[model samples]
Target: MNQVGSLIFLVALFLFSTFLNWYVFQAYKTVLSGVDSERSKQMLNLIYWIVFGGISIWVVYTFHQIFKAGEISTAHQQVLNVFLTIVVTQLVCTIFLFGEDIFRNIQAGFSLLVNGKSETSFPTRLKWLSIIAIAISMVPFTSFVYGITKGKYNFTVHREIIYFDDLPDAFDGFTITQLSDIHAGSFKNLDAVKKGVDLAIAQQSDLFVFTGDLVNHEAGEIEPMIDIFNKIKAPYGQFSIIGNHDYGDYVSWESPEAKAENFKKFIKQHERLGYKLLIDEHVVIEKDGQQITLVGVQNWGKGFQSKGDLTKAMEGVASENFKILLSHDPSHWDYEAKNEPRKIHLTLSGHTHGMQFGIETPLIKWSPVQYRYPNWAGLTAYQGRFLYVNRGFGFHAFSGRVGIWPEITVIELRKK
Candidate 1:
């Protein structure tokens, strides 16, 4: 957005947040009613406002920097993370407080109608309800703190064994390690990142594919960690396709040539990292005289970039050959890949990052991203074709992840 538009948004957000804080303060006062020491209560109230006031200043400064630079630095992102955490926690508290207020007002109204007089001077705030609200608010408060401190780097490996009826005999049990959305610019802990890379290397899969989003905005973001990622080598080869962010579309550039130069550097970084960057192209992986097609396309999605040319990428490849597609966004599979006449046996993707937050368990696997992209994370099959959306290897706009931790996906292809 333009500077004026961004400024207006920030002002509106500030006003809304200020109102939310005011409403939540009522709950705080009710919860503190039992405190014996007036001084202590006063001090506590002062501290609460001070903390939120400081957060407000930080947020304004961070946005100002973003407006000036056309990009958010890692430090600025952390500020946003903290701001979001606080706002969400306050909103949770507001929900409970608002509900209780509604109930109390209704009770008061009923009493006035029935008795012809108000039973009480005013509806007293329920201390116990306020306490409960505050207590529950801590859950998300602590979770957000932990997510920032540890969850972003808590790289989890997800393994899926996909069965295919037309799979090549030589390719049975073939494992492909997939990583996506590295967003190298967001890395804060190099040692932790190295551990995730080490884990990917330990998988020792036959092939390694990075779906996309190597950097947040520019190619230079990964320059510092090229060697760290280069460690992820496989027996077949390491291949990559572009993501929406790699084109430098999110940030401002002095000229079109500058943006083009940045993209060129991004492509060069892939080469330096020992990955064969594919743009609307296909590579055949041969094992024991049998071949499987690996088709990669540029960032194609339902709402994002649609530069990926599936037909062009599949040219020359036999329709019967077992196909594995490297697409950044799962939407591509939902909209195009799965319905292709040539029949893609498998498509690997990562762009959602499972929204970096959600619950995933044996009985419940859910993230907000699912509402946007149906096949968000893990394995989903349609008409015998499989799509595995890796949660991502790094964080993005949000400085950290919550329940949906960073992921390294390993898919074992088995012949049905």
Candidate 2:
């Protein structure tokens, strides 16, 4: 489903961005038609189209990243957006062109103060420079799209559930490493993924976990990073679960056999990486006679259908053991884990990679993802329950993280 949704998003953005580029091109042509010098106007118009065309593509890439998490209405008042964008874009271009003029004039004035007139004033060429600026404004976006095409890291959370800090007198300063939402096939190949894996190992975590999104759609994409993931050495072993991206629900398949084969290969890859893939199951990790029940379920969502069977996963677990959960989507922590019959003490998740971009500050930090999920990233404690959201190990297709760098959460579980 994740794979198909991503494709749908890409297609939608592709269409939408193409329409916007056409609009910009038309506007540029209209402006050029009225200019006194047709030849210069035509040259400037061509430049405008190229630059804005590139920008439209970059905007489309950003839209694609945001749309995959949920259904968004791109066409609602799109005509208005185009018109407004063109007007505002023109204004921006005019400001830059005029600002350059003002700066040059100021510089000339300074020279005149020292040497007088400097060199003939150069005459006013401001007539059509605004058009040139309008066209030139799109260059940055074009370069950005090219950058994304080169490579992007779409990583999931590392959902490690071991004790991190002062652990119940029985366990002490235990560290758990976690990752989530690794959209494997979304890009060409792994680049900085090894750095992420090595960073996870450097935390000296006791246990490691990967909560889901192991593949974009086809499980074979999981093969490339097996060796890198194997480097995540933990004393208690690594555990994992199926995220929405894991079930092969997105693309068409000729037969169940082919799909099963794809799924098996990914499973084998996870095994080779030394991870215990838990599907709606429980594992008991013991230390000093005290047991921590690690419950992992399939995917669950607030709006989307629940693929995870939370109840079934914890069926055989003892009531006395302290429970920790590995649920992919943050919504699971908000709705299910907190209110579960057994009542989980801590929950770990990674589906929201903070949408791979946003602003963070000492006073307050926020990502666009926060509007959807309550605890989008970082640690949240509520009603004595704890959830740690790993910002994630890699990025999505819009790869570069502005304020939120790709992260590997090293949680030191403290027993208070």
Candidate 3:
């Protein structure tokens, strides 16, 4: 955006944030009114100002750097993300308090109209409502704290049993473990990261496939975790494909040569991590006397990079083959894989990361990203072709995950 537009947007955000802080302060003052502990009240007041002051200073500093650089650095962006998480979560708590206040006001209005005397006078706070508000505020506060501390590395294995009528008896009960979007650059906790990697290794699936996104922007990011990633193994083999981030497209480079060099390094990093980097190529997995085709293409999506070539990948494969295609973005399944004449039985993807935050349970699953991508996560099918978008092995911009924890997907192939 232009400088004027950016400044205006920043000012508006600051105003809104200030208003929320004021609302929080007012509610807090009323809540602490009946309490006798002066020290508790003082501590609360100190916390309120410290958090607000820190956020304000962060905002000003971030905008100043953005204005000077004409773009935000990764560190600045991460700081903004962390700060916004706190601000937005607190704002949500404030909104709940406002709702309670509105309800109490309505009740008072009704009492005044009916009995000519309201239960409480104007500006009188309901102690119960205030208490409820405080309790409600702790929900997001605790949840966010958990997200930062434990949620990111809390890897869970999601298993799916998919059956096909085109029976390959030899391949029945075959297990394939998929891990995608290991944005190594964003990892901070080495021990926690190693724990997640260990979980993936423990699965012991017959085959392992890393759909895409080995690094966030450059290959060097994966250097530290090279040994940890190499621990992941399967009897059949481990294969991988490129994602948009692997190309180093998001950041500016000193020259075209540097960008090309970075891309080459990313390729080598995949090799170092023991992934048979496939680029618009096909491989056959043979077990006993049956065979299934596994094709991989470069990163492709409707709105993303268009380097993947399904036609090239499926060159020698027949239409009747039990093909499992690996393309990073789930959108590729919608636009190309499912529509291919040579039917792709299953497509693996992991670009969305379910926005790295959402409520996913057996009963109710929902994420904001669902509105943008039809095949956002989990198993989705179109015209009998299945697409499984792994929730991702790691996180990205947000740095932490909430309800949507890091995922390790294990798919068992059953012949119907």
Candidate 4:
């Protein structure tokens, strides 16, 4: 956006945050009104402003740094996460307080109509109502804190078995372990990351594939963890495709040449990790003298990068071949892959990260990202074509995962 537009947006956000702070403060006072110790009340008020006001100032400073540098450092990202958590918690409390005020006004209006005179004083704030609001707000406050502390490294494995009538007999019972979105720049704990890599290695799948997003902004981000990731090797082969972030488009560079150099390094990093990086190409995996086609395309989503050419990737491969496609964005399936006349048997993608937060259980699976992408996470089939969207092997923008932990997917392919 233009400079003026950015300034206006920041100002508007500051004003809204200030209003929430003031409104929540009223509820705080009501909840503490019964306390007789003036000193204790004064101390509590001081702590409240120190946290809310301090975080607000930090947020403004972080934004300034981002605007100037065209990048958000890890420290700045964490500060933003903390600010978001506090704002959400305060908004929850504000809802209850606002409702109480409306009820108070209605009661006063009823009294005036009955008595033929306005009440001399407003009704006292309901201490219990405020107390309940504060108590409930803690749920989100604690959840965000836990997410930042531990949830990001909590890797979970998801297993799926898919059967295909047209599958090659030699490829039956073939197991493929898939990972996606290893935003290496966002990782802070190396040991924890290694543990996740080890878990993927232990899966012992026949083929290993990474869908995309090896790094967040630049290739340098993955340099530190190369050894850990290289440990993930499969018997058939390890293959990968590029995601939108791997192009280094999110951050500014000194020149076009510098950005191009970064892109080159990113591709090399894939080679260094022993992955056959496929840029709109196909590779044949032969087992027991029979074969299946594995086609990989560059980032191709509805709104994001549309560089992947399915036709070029599938060239020379017959339409009757049992095919598995490596695509970074699930929207590719929604927009192109699933609708192709040649019929791709399976497509793997992992761009959404399930918003890194949502509830997933046996009965209900919901995330805010589902509204934007039809196939946000897990397995979904459309007209006999299947798409498996991995939740991601790492965290990003938010710095943590809440209900949806980082994922490693093991998919077994069987002949029907």
Candidate 5:
């Protein structure tokens, strides 16, 4: 947005946030009135400053960072830390306040019916209700704190065995490990990030594939982490495809030449990391006189960039050859890859990042992003074709992950 538009948006957000803080504080103060101890009053006052005052400071910091940097960069983690903390606390407090209001209205209605009076003696704020609100708010506060401190680095390995009826006999037990959306700009702790790369290295798969999104906006973002990523090795080799963010399309440039230069650097970074960058192309992997087709296309989605050409990538390959496609966005599987004339036995993707938060357990799995993209996370099949969307190897804008931890996916091929 332009400077004028950005200023208006900031002003509106500041006013709305100020009102929300006032509303929550008023609800908190109602409970303070019932306590008579001087020590208790001082403790409550301290709590108010810590919660409400912290939020106000974060608002100022966010605005300052946006103005100075022109966007939210990796340098603004401290601001985001406060933002996540206050949002969860306010939501829980608001819910309790709503319940208290409902109870108060019910009491006043009963009094009017029995005594023919419109008034009642019920306290304006019940101490018990306020205590409940504070206690409930703690749950989310603790969880988010953990998410910021540890969850982002808690890389989980997901292993799956995909069986195919048309598999090549020479490649029966071939294993492939996939990582996606490194978003190298978002990484902060190099040691912690190294541990994740080490985990992928320990797998010792025959082939490794990084689906897309090597950097957030520019190639310079991955400079520091380039050596760390170079540690990933496999016997066959590593391959990659481009994602929307790798094109540097979201950020503004001084000139079209500058943007083109940045893209050139992006390709150079991939080559330095030993990844065979594919742009709407295909490669043949041969083992003991048996070959399988590996097709890769540029970032393509229903509403986003549609640069992928399935036909061009599959030009010379025979339809009978078992094929594995690497696509960045899962939407491609639903819209194009699945319905294409030539059959793609399996596709590897990672773009959604599970929205970086959700409830994912053995019994149930859900994330808000599901509403936008139906084939969001994990393994999904359509008419004997499979699509595995890696959760992601790193995070983006939010600076941290919640229940949906970062992932390294390992898929084993079995000939049926």
Candidate 6:
């Protein structure tokens, strides 16, 4: 499921660049087709500014990412941030630039039909028509970009669940902190990662869970910052499950053996950080005489092929215990996900990253992922179970959260 998002997100940027440039080129061609009057020359000059300069800026940013992808440091982190900001701004600007011409074209079309000007200049007629489709689609894309940048991420908890039966009476007020999709990359450095872990610790959570994507594609991208997460403290335990990114599938692997070795190493890294890595297994957390089951599964998704084996994970388990699932993608919930025959009471997932863009507010919130999952963020009830789609403690390819600030979900599990 995350791979779907990654492919779409990466494709969106590329298609947008290609199509935008094409439309602009088409518009530039029209402007030049007419006579070389003062107005034609003026329009040509303005069009050149938009085309050549835009291409130049685009080239610099793309090359910058290529050049700096291997060097993960504080300075490069800043560079990535600025680079993303510029690209995002350009995405927004392109829609508007293309749209303006589109609107003008529509007006010209209508003018030709009603006023009967069949012989309108090629430049005048073509510019408007070339931009018509671009303008319409840009409306929604612009709205998405604007809503994300301006802060509009609206979500709600699902209604299939009411409460957890195994929550201790004394723990009616207990809050567990959940972190997910912390991709720590060239964009996110040690200090930023520390700030998130530190904030999670400050919640004084009864338990803490990281549901994968601790690092983007590279396991060692976070090696230098391992000690920072090791600083996190929790009473019950700090648990983690692997996300898709942990599998080393993002980069080429020499052999199946190498990929397996890398995944094992990632598990070891989490242990070094004082986290109890749950790879298709469950551990009982007991307080006083009461106990709850904490289950961890590998990255599983309905649309993505991966190593998550939920049944094998629950194999030796007794159904009497209260279970909290630490799976990566929310789509797992759809596979009878949270509502599977196993009767999982609470599931924590974080692969969505809230799309790393969008706004969460009292009303009218959305993200590119909203089209996929219903509970893309926060606590929700599902078929008599609970699922928390955490917004995540870290950012990925894009640094800043346009509207949805990174979240540290403190979920309170109260006894019925």
Per-model TM-score versus the true fold: 0.94, 0.69, 0.87, 0.94, 0.89, 0.73
lDDT (Cα, 0-100) at 398 in candidate 1: 85
Q: Rate residue 195 of model 2 by lDDT.
A: 59
User: Lowest summed lDDT over 10 consecutive residues: which window, candidate 5?
Assistant: 114-123
For residues 57-105, write the lDDT of model 6, one tens digit per residue: 5644554444435323444444445555445544554555556667768
- Write the residue-wise lDDT of candidate 3 on 1-416 in tens digits: 57898778788877877777777777778777877999988988889878886787677668767666643456875776667576756677687777877887887787788777645455466667766776777777777678776888889999999988884899999999999999888887888889988888898999999999888777899999999998888899999999988888877688999999999898888888898999999999999978999999999988889999889888989888899999999989887788988888999999999987778887988888999998898998787889999999888767677888899999999998
**Which pairs, if any, clash in model 5?**
none
> Which sections of candidate 1 miss by over 4 Å?
36-43, 117-122
Clash totals for all models, in order? 0, 22, 0, 0, 0, 6
> Could you give candidate 5's per-residue lDDT for residues 1-416 as a string of tens digits?
67797778777766766666776776678777878998998898788777676777677668766665655676566676667677767778878887887888898788778767645565477777777887888887887788888999999999999999989998999999999999998887999989999999999999999999998889899999889999898888899999988999877788999999999999999999999998899999989999888899999987888888888888898988899999999999998898877899999999999988777999989988899989888999989899999999988877778789999999999988
The total number of steric clashes, by the backbone 3 Å criterion, in model 4 comes to: 0
Q: Per-residue lDDT tens digits of candidate 1, residues 1-416? A: 78899889789877877787788899988888889999999999999888887687778778878888888888888888988898879988999998988998998888788776745455798898888998999988898999999989899999999888888899989998999999998996899989999999999999999999999998999988998999889999999999998889988899999999998899999999999999999999999999999999999989887999999999998889889999999999999999999989899999999999888999999887889999999998898988889999998878888899999998999988
**For each candidate, what is the lDDT?**
0.90, 0.68, 0.85, 0.91, 0.87, 0.69
Clashes of 2: 22
Candidate number that wins on lDDT, 1 or 6? 1
| Best TM-score among the predictions, by candidate number | 1
- The positional error of residue 381 in candidate 3, measured at the CA in angstroms, is 2.1
Worst 10 residues of 1 by lDDT: 114-123
lDDT of 4 by residue, 1-416 (tens): 56897788778777888888889999888877888999999999989888787777778777777777777789888887888788879988998998999999998888778776755456888998999999999987888888888999999999999999998898889999999999999997999999999999999999999999999898999999999999989999999999999999889998999999999999999999999999999999999999999999999988898999999999998889889999999999998999998999999999999998788999999998999998999999999999999999998778888889999999999988
The runs of at least 3 residues in candidate 2 whose Cα sits more than 4 Å from the true structure, single-residue gaps closed, are 1-38, 50-167, 187-191, 397-400
For candidate 6, which ten residues in a row score worst on lDDT? 151-160
Cα error of candidate 4 at position 374, Å: 2.6
Superposition TM-score, candidate 2 onto the true structure: 0.69
TM-score, predicted candidate 1 vs. hidden true structure: 0.94
